[model samples]
Target: MGFDTATTTLLRAILDEVCESISRHETGVRAHVASKILEAATKGEKTPDGLKQIGRAALSEAPTMWR
Candidate 1:
């Protein structure tokens, strides 16, 4: 799906915020969280709070390699 520039920008910002919140520096983990947030955005979730919730939820559920 082709997202307009605004939505694309919003998603990027949201993803960056989520990654920052989680203190995630790994490229793979960041990409995974970004993809999850993008999926939510594509599904019509637009609010930053809602997107952040989705991202945090995904992070909480994601398996830890070291754990």
Candidate 2:
């Protein structure tokens, strides 16, 4: 199993943005959303309600950019 540099970079960037966003959501990422995201991530499934997406949305709504 191997990942190209581009994929690694993209993942890193997304994670960075997601983390920053999570730190700022007033409503917060609920336990259920986190759980679903974790499960999908662990299983390597295509995330339906992806945490990154939700996080970025919250971030964009507030004070961050998902760059």
Candidate 3:
């Protein structure tokens, strides 16, 4: 009920192609844009193992004001 299989499959394939173009990243600091592909494949709101680390730093972790 979370990962869109169709999207994940397509994205995963794209990541494969991209990695081929850059085996030894010279000075790049970015991960594969399709990292979501892996996340969706592994995690699904229920699991957190394969979740992409992208944007995670910006995600709000503070508790809500719903006391």
Winner by TM-score: 1
- Compared with the true structure, all predictions reach lDDT values of 0.80, 0.48, 0.38
List ranges where model 3 is wrong by over 4 Å.
24-32, 35-67
Ranking of predictions according to lDDT: 1, 2, 3
**Better model by TM-score: candidate 2 vs candidate 3:** 2
Give the alpha carbon lDDT tens digit for every residue of 1-67 in model 3: 3447765565545454444434444213124334444555445422332233332321222122311
lDDT of 3 at 16: 49
Which candidate do you rate higher for lDDT, 1 or 2?
Answer: 1
What is the per-residue lDDT of model 1 for residues 1-67, given as tens digits with 9 covering 90 to 100? 8899998898888878777755555666777787899899888998989999998887776668612
Candidate 2: regions farther than 4 A off: 21-51, 54-67
Query: What is the alpha-carbon RMSD of candidate 1 to the true structure?
Result: 2.2
Query: Order the candidates by TM-score, highest first — what do you get?
Result: 1, 2, 3
Model 2 quality (TM-score): 0.36
- Worst 10-residue lDDT window for candidate 3 reads 58-67
Better of 2 and 3 by lDDT: 2
